[model samples]
Target: MKDHLSALVQKANLGDREALEQVLLKIKDLVYNLSLKMLLFPEDAKDATQEILIKVVTHLSTFNHKSQFKTWVYRIATNYLLNHKGKRSKEFAMPFKDYTDLIDLGHSNEVRYTKNEGELSLLEEEVKVSCTQGLLLCLNEIDRMVYILTDILGFNGVEGSEILGISSENYRQKLSRSRAKVRSFLNNKCGLVNPENPCRCTKKIDFLIDQKIVNPKDLRFAHFSDRSIDLVGRIDDLEKSVAIYRSTPNFPAPEELLEEIKTTLKIN
Candidate 1:
């Protein structure tokens, strides 16, 4: 597949539309699924998907093929979303800061850092899940991009460092401290503030708040109970999780829209 992508990219760069179309068909789902996970909103996902298509079309000539095709495609999608700056631009976004401090990194920097490579890796996952709950509320746009690209997307520290234009060691250092901050926040929010203390909200909010990325409905003072938890979980576990995930209408794949975009861009 890698070799095929390399060939396709070379062909596309030389102005082969058929090769580009074949590559697009091969990667369409990978691109869509990634956007779905990151943006956490269907509209945003679709918009990002469309924007990625345009970018892939325009930038196809610039692909160096040093990374995998999948990686290059994902880079396009990430850049599209991160570039949308300003007021409520993220309103349509799954903006992490807008969520209640689900992960709590309070005032403490007591996060454990060891020289042991094995130990750093072993603790990384647990720390990531726990910290995201609290510190997501505090992370701004660029920070969220770096964290998501490295942690959630499974990009290597070095790869992530290059993408964010930082040294690998520096990225690793920041990642460790950021996770600590998030864990601290989550711990505090879940009412584990004091090792001897209890939660402020009931058991319900405690459970919901511990999730790495919770919905906006629960964050805005809307209470969810045990039954609601079960309901939400069951719905997710359903065989049709993708089919009924949202209550909103799907945007039409209108020809006029495509024609408008194509005519404006002068891409036959």
Candidate 2:
């Protein structure tokens, strides 16, 4: 795959429009997913991804071959997101602690008696998806990017460092701090991490449903049948816990969006 992408990059650099389009197609999902994770909103992520791709196409001729093409693309993405000045989603403004508290209060005996096991499971998945995405937002931009690259997306330290334009040591330090923060938050508040926690996804389902945060019939994250966070490969103890939340399947860029990008690039 790397060799094929390298060939595509070479052809793209040589002014082959078809190669350039293929290159964009290959990396479009990656760019969009990273933006979605970072921005925490679909529309914002879509806009950011589109902007970044345009920048990448405009600068394709300047890409030095010292790094892998994937790494270079990521560097473009990371830099774009770091400096992006856009309003964050309101969902991210609410503190995780406040979310937990709301769940605790909402999970009264009356609610528990009303919801069955299947309903509770569905709700838990929604909360897990929403809360995990929210947790990433809690980190500052750089830290958040580091955690997403290394922990979620499975980039190694060297590649992650290259993408962020930081030393490997610096990358490790940032990743450590980010991981620690997320781990602590989950252990304390997420029922998936600790059974003792009062914020079980099941308990929060009714509350989320009542507040319109989650709709039972039209579930968002819960209906993604292709992948779940559990599928992320874990290398060691550090990843064991983080993987639980980061294991969702890679989100694909919309087909129409890809076509729009292709047309904008004027590929025949």
**Top candidate by lDDT:** 2
Off by over 4 Å in 1: 33-38, 85-89, 92-138, 188-268
Question: Can you tell me which runs of candidate 2 are displaced by over 4 Å?
Answer: 85-91, 94-105, 108-123, 215-219, 225-240
Model 2 per-residue lDDT tens digits across residues 1-268: 9889988988998988888889999999999989888887667888899889999989988888777887888999999998884465544545556645654566643454245766666666776686678677777789989999988888999989988999999999999999898888877776666667777556666677787766678765666633353343443454445767556666778678777777787766
Best candidate (score: TM-score): 2
- Give the Cα lDDT of each candidate: 0.49, 0.76
Clashes of 2: 2
Model 1 RMSD to the real structure? 13.3
- TM per model? 0.53, 0.84
lDDT of 1: 0.49
Q: Give the per-residue lDDT digits (tens) of candidate 1, residues 118-171.
A: 433333322322232223325555565665665545578888777666788888
